[model samples]
Every structure is written in structure tokens, then in C-alpha cells.
Target: MATWAIGDIQGCFDEFTALLRAIDFRPDRDRLWLVGDLVNRGPKSLETLRFVHSLGDGAITLLGNHDLHLLAVAAGHGRLRRGDTLDEVLGAPDREPLLDWLRGRPLFHYDPALDMAMVHAALAPGWDLATAKTRAAEVQTALTSDADGYFAHMYGDTPHRWDNALRGWRRLRVITDYLTRVRFCRPDGTYDMRAKGPPGTQPEGYLPWFALPDRASAGTPIVFGHWSSIGLVDGHDVYALDTGCVWGRQLSALCLEEGRWVSVDCSARGSGAGD
Candidate 1:
């Protein structure tokens, strides 16, 4: 039974299927792990969601920012923005089961047998393997519980240092941002929601989350998406799998068991089109 960790799908259903075919993925035998962003921005969000939901126990998915945005909009927390393309899902006939399955998903997932912890974004510095699992569980538990209030509060870009005393919706928002939208943080742990390009463009005193000192899950591989502009980066310990699927470049997948990368070119599509 092979286990493959695929990059952000972001609604690019065609590429997803092509990649699976290329890998000879058999749902009945092989397990598939996803870095998340299974829907949104691409042309076939509905198909993507359906395929993922059917994977059942053979699938491991860590939630991505777009995935949450879908839930938020479905729950009436956010409006559809320009360039958004998720209507097919929010208006689908089977939307209830899909959304429920998504809500039940977690922000972090690790199989100790695989020795890998998966997330949507980078882990904060100074957290060890245990801490990664613990903190991820903390936020995910809240999201899975009575989290309507949590969704209402999961916006903004302030109150940066992760203090345990952080209470109410504000705390939930911070944790959500960390697990979902973060790329870089200030030296003191302030999030940079504005920085979106590759590394090195951040202001002084701000550094990418992976660059922080004594990071959590130091040697354990963390498969993640959510930074297409960041592309595929190899930091020796983390896998940046958001290979600009929505940007007309390519969708990527890594065989974690062997640390192999396979990319399906989306350049055949329009220059600025992908998921």
C-alpha cells in the first residue's frame, strides 16, 4: 500500500486526476495524503470535493485556507470575492455531506507510523514534534466543536505572540491564521499577512516561519500547501507543496515514503489560470 502526499489541489480537478493516473493510485490499495486546498479558484471545485470525500479512510487531508474559506462562506461568515470560483460546491445538491466532512477534518494530521506531521502552513519556531501535534490539536478541536463563534473571529492580523492567556474569538482567530494563512512572522512572532512572494522580500525583523530558531517538528517532515507564490521549496525538513496549481504552473505531489516529487505541468493552460 503506497502512501502519496499530494500538493494543493485548489480545484484543479483535471490535474488531480492526471496525477493520480500517472502514479497508478488505486484507492482500494494505496493511501493518499493531501496538503489541502481541495477546492476553490479552479474550474471544477465540485468534482474535486466529491472525489476527495469519497476517498474515505484511504485519504488523509489537512485543511488549507481555501478549504476554510469555503466553509466560512457556506456558514455565512464571508462574501464571495472577485475571482472566487467555488459556487459549484456551495450550491451543490450534496453540499451538506461535503461541508460536514470538511468541518470534521483537522488542521494537523500525523501518522507516527509514517513519522510525518502534515499541515496547511509552516509551524511556529520553538515547537517540538509533540508541541506541533498538541498545538494543532488545540486549534482543530475548537474548529470541530461549537466553532461558529470561532469562524466569526477568524479574521484580522493582530495580537501576534501566541500567549496561552489568549481568550475567546481573538484567540481562535490567531490560531486559525497561524495554521492557515501564515508565511512569515515578526522576530517577536507577529504575523505578516501582507507578505506573499517568495522569501527575502519581508521587512527587517520579519522572517519566514520555517526560519525561526528551534522550530517544532525539526526532523519530522511536515507536508503543506497554501503558498503557490512560494512554490516548491526544499528546506531539508519541510515540503512546500503548493506548486501554484491555480497559477497555471503545475500541481505537485511527493512520495513521502521515498521523498520523491512529481509535477504535472499546467502551463498548457492559460498563463494565469490554475487552482
Candidate 2:
């Protein structure tokens, strides 16, 4: 059986299907690991959600910022953004099941036997695999238990760093930021959420999280997708898969065990940058 890890779909269902076809994906025998952002910004958010959800055990998706935003909006905690294409999803007849299923997805996915892990964004510089998993579970619990309350407090850059002493929403907020929206960060695990460009454009004091010299997760193989600006990078023990498919770029995927890569060109331009 083959295991393929795909980049953000972001409602670009046509390109997503094309990429799957290019990989010759056999749902009965192959497994797909999606690096989140399965909806929004493209034309078919509703179809995208249903297609992935229909995949059942054949697929696994981690939650990205867009996925969380969908939940927040569904819970009446977030406002529709200028470029959001989530109306189809919100108005769908199956919206409840789709949103609930999305909320249940983990913020991080790791398999020790395969020596692989996946997160929508960066793993905190200070977190090892075990600690990252535990922290993810903590946030997941809060998200599942009180989705509205969680969504209400989810929007922020506060407590911009991770601290063991952090408790309540502060701790969950920081963890959510790291696992979903992080790109550049200080070595101390403090985030630079405002920097949306590629590595060279980041502030002088910060570095791409994966580039940190002392990152505890450095040696662990990770698959992440939030940095579409960085495109399809493969290095630093991580595979960067978000190829800006929703922005007229290519949809990409990596064969985990073989380290092979495949992609399909996309023509849809749904949203602008800094999503």
C-alpha cells in the first residue's frame, strides 16, 4: 500500500482530483494524508469537504488555519473574510457533519514507525515529537468540548511564545498558532505571524521555524503545508507541500515511503496571498 501526503486543497477540487489521478491513487490500496486547508479560497468548498469526508479511512487530514476559520465562522465566532469562498460549505445540507468532522481532526499527525509527522504549520522550536503530540491533544480536547468558546478565543497572536506555565486559553492559543499559522519564529519559540513572505523576506531576528539551529523537532521527518510562498520545498527533514494550487499554481503530493513527488497544474485563482 502506498501512502501519499498532499498539499492544501483549499477548495480547489478539480486540481485535487487531477493530482490524485496523476498519482494513480487507488483508494482501496492507498492512503492519503492531507496537510489541511481542505476548504475556502477556491470555488468548491462544499464539494471539497464532501469528497474528502467520503474518503473515510482512506484519508487523514490535519486542521489548518482555514479549516479552523471555517469552524469559527460556523460557530458564529468569526466573520467572513473578503476572499472567503466558504458560503457553499456553510449553506450545504450536510454542513453539520462536515464541520464537526473537521473540528475533530487533529492539529498534528505523527507516526513513529514511519518516522514521519505532519502539521499544517510549524512544530514549535522547543517541542519534541512527544511534547508536540501532547500539546496537540490538549488543544483538540478544548476544541471538541466547547467549539464555540474555543473559536471565540482562538483569534489572536497573544502570548506569542510557548511557555509550560501557560494555561487556559493562552496555552491553547499559542499551540494553535504554532501548529497552524506559524511560519517564521525566534529560537525561543516566539512567533512572527505578520511575516507572510518567503524566507529571505522575514525579519532579521527571526528564521523560518524549520531553519532554527536548535529546533527539537529538527531531526524528525515532518510534512507541512501552510507556506504556499515557499511552495514545494523538500529539506530540513520536512516536506513543504502547499504549492499555491488555489492561486493558479500546482497541487503537489509526496510518496512518503519512496520520497517521490507528483503534481498537477492548477488554473483557478481564488484568493490572494497572506491567507
Candidate 3:
């Protein structure tokens, strides 16, 4: 069986399917590691969610910021913003089951045999694999057990650094940000939440999270998306698969075993700004 890691879908169902076809994906024999953003900002949020949900065990999807936003909005904690195309999903008959499945999805996934880890965004400089797993579980527990409470305090950019002493919703929010919203940060693990441009555009004193010196997770190969501006990076023992598909670029996929890429052009489908 083959394992393919795909970049963000972001509700671009047609492009997603096209990429799947280009990769010759067979649900019965291949597994998909989706780097989240499964819905939002594209033309078919509802269809995208339904299709991924139908994949069941054939796919392992992390929860991206968009997915979390969907959950938050569904739970009445977040409001739909301009350019959001999630109305169909919110109005769908299966919205509850879809949101439930999404909420239950983990923030991190690791495959020991492959010696690879996946997250929707970047890992904090301080978190090694074991620590990442533990921290992820903390948010997962809060999301499942106290979603109301978690979502209530989920949106923020404070506590810009990781602290072992952090407590309550602040702790959960930072953890979630590292896994889902981070891009640039300092070697000290302080996030520059405002820098969203490609490399060389980060604010002074900041480096891309993966480029931070002596990152604890540096030894293990990581697969991640969420930074579409710096598309398709294969170095630093990490694979960045977000090729800006939602922005009129290519939808990319990497074969885990072969380390080869298969992409589908998405110029026709791309629209809206990427987060």
C-alpha cells in the first residue's frame, strides 16, 4: 500500500479530485495523509467535507485553522468572515457528523515505521516528537471534553511563546496556534503571528519555525502545510506540501515512499487570499 501526503484542499473539490487522479489514488489500497484545511474559501466546502469524511480510514486528516474555525462557528463561538465559503457546510444536513469528525481529528500524526510526523502547520521550536504528541493530546482532550470552553477562548495571538508553566485556555490556544497557525517564530519559540509572507519577508529577529536553530523536532522528518507562500520545500528534513492550490497554483502531493511529487494545476479554481 502507498501513503501519499497531500497539501491543503481548502474546499477546492475539483482540484483535489484532479490531483488524486493524477496520483492514481486508490482508496482500497492507498492511504492519504491530508495536511488539513479540508474546507473553506473555495467553491465546494460541503462536497469536500463529505468526500473526505467518506474516505474513513483511507485518510488521516489533521485539523487546520479553517477546520477549527468551522467547528468554532458551528458551535457559535466564531462568526463567518468575508471570503468564507463555509455556508454550505454549515447548512448541510450532515454538518453535525462532519463537524464532530473534524473536531475529533488530532493536531499531530506520527508514523514510526516511516519515521515521519505530520501537522497542519509548524511545531514549536521547543517541542520534540514526544512533547508534540503530549501537547497535542492536551488540546484534543479540551476540544472533545470542553469544546464550548475551548472555542470560547480559541482565537488569539497572545502568549506568543511556549511556556511549560502556561495554564488554562491560554495554554490550549498557544498549542493550537503552533500546530495550526504558526509560520515565523524566534529560536526562543516566540511566534510572529503577523508575518505571513514568503521567506525573506519575516520581521527582524524571526525565522521560519522550521528554520529556527536547534529545534527539538529537527531530527525527525515532518510533513506539513499551511504556508502556501513558501510552497513545496523539501529540505530541512521537512516536506512543505501547500503549493497554493487555493490561490491559483498547483495542488501538490508527495509520495512518502518515493519522495516524489505529483501536482495538478489549479489556476481555474483558485481564488481568495490564503491564511
Candidate 4:
């Protein structure tokens, strides 16, 4: 069975399905690794969530920032942003189950045999695979056990760097950020949360998280999304597949075993970018 890794769908169900078709995805025989942002910003959030939920074991989906925001809003911890299209999901009959499944999803996934790891965004420069897994479990535990408290303190850009001594909400928030919202960061691993543009446009002292010198997770290949502006990156043992389908670009997928890409145009379904 082939394993295919796909970029953020962001509720663009038509483009998602089209890309699936383009890849000749066979749910019965193939497994899918989705880089999250499964819902929000497009026209059919409910449909997109339902379809992915229906896939069950056929797919492994990480929780993106949008996915967490949906849960936070549903739990009354977050306010809806101007471009959010998550109302349908919030109002759906199956919203509870859908959100529950999403909350339980891990922030990181690893395949020891392939030595490949996946996260919605980037790993902290200091975190090797072992540290990533442990830290991810910490947040997962908090999310599952005290979602109210977890979402309550989830928003922020402080503690811009990871510290082994961090604890409580501070620790959880930093881990969540690294696994979900990270982009440009300093060589010392301090995140430049404000820099969202492409690589060359990063702030003076920052570089893409993956480009950080001597990153502990450097050797192992990482499949990630969340930086659509940079589009598809297929080298340096990093696979960035978020091709901005929601922004009138292509929805991309990479065959893990073969390292080949299959994409579908999404201009007709484009609805601009939304966080």
C-alpha cells in the first residue's frame, strides 16, 4: 500500500477531492498522511471535516492551527475571525464527535521505519525526534484531560524559545506553537512569530525553522505544511506541501515511498488566505 502526504485542505472540499482523484487515491488500499488545517476558510468546512472523519484509519491527520482554533471557538475560548468559514462545522449535528476526534489527534507523527516525521508546522530546533514526541504527548494529555484550560491559555506568542524548565500553561503553549504555528526563528531557536512571508523576506536575524543551523531534527525527514507562502519545498530532507489551494493555487500531494507529487489546480475554488 502506498502512503501519500497531502497539504492543508482548509475546507476546500472540491479541490481536495480533485487532488485525491488526481492522485488516484484508493482508500481501501492506500494510507493518507494529511498535514492538517482540515477545515476553515473555504466554502465547505462541514463537508471537508465529515469526509476526512469518514476516512477513519485510512488517514492520519495532524491538528493544524485552524483545527485548534475551531475547537477553541466551539469551546468558547476563541472568537471567530473575519474570514472564518467554520460556522457550518460549529452548527453541524456531529460537531461534538468531529471536534472530539480532532482534539484527540496527535500534534506529531513519526514512522520509525521510514525515519520520517510529520507535524502541522515545524519542530523546535532543539527538539530531536524523541524530544518532539515527548513534548507532543504533553500537550496531547493536556488537550484530552483539560481542554477548557488548554484552549484558555492556547493563544499567545510569548516564551519565544523552548526551555526545558518551562512548566504549566507556558510549557504547553510553547510546544503547541512549535508544532503548529512556527515559521521563521533565530539560530538560538527563538521564534519570529511575526514573519510570515517567504524565505528571503525573513527578518534580519531569522531563518526558516528547517534551515536553522545544527537543528536537532535535521537528519530525519519532516513532512509539514502551514507555510503556504513558501509553497512546495521538496529538498533538504524537508517536504513542504501546502500549495495554497485556498488561495487559488494547486492542492499538492507527495507519494511518500516514491517521492513524486500529484497536484490539481484550485483557481475556481480559491477564496483567499485565512488563518
lDDT of 2 by residue, 7-121 (tens): 9999999988988999999999999999999998889888889999999989989999999999999899999998899998898889899888999999988977689999999
Clashing pairs in 2: none
* Superposition error at 104 for model 1 (Å): 0.6
Q: In each prediction, how many residue pairs overlap at the backbone (N, C-alpha, C within less than 3 A)?
A: 4, 0, 0, 0
Deviating ranges (above 4 Å) for candidate 1:
267-275
Error of 1 at 271 (Å): 6.6
Whole-model Cα lDDT per candidate? Answer: 0.80, 0.91, 0.92, 0.90
Q: In candidate 1, what are the lDDT values of residues 98-192, reduced to their tens digit?
A: 99899888887888899887888866665566766777777678777866766777766777667677877777677777778888876556777
User: What's model 4's lDDT at 124?
Assistant: 91
**Model 2 bad stretches (over 4 Å):** 268-272
Question: What value does the lDDT take at residue 61 in candidate 4?
Answer: 94
* Candidate 4 CA-lDDT value: 0.90
Which sequence of candidate numbers ranks them by lDDT, best first?
3, 2, 4, 1
Candidate 3 local Cα displacement, residue 72, angstroms: 0.5
What residue runs in model 3 are displaced by over 4 Å at the alpha carbon?
269-273
For candidate 2, what is the total of clashing residue pairs?
0
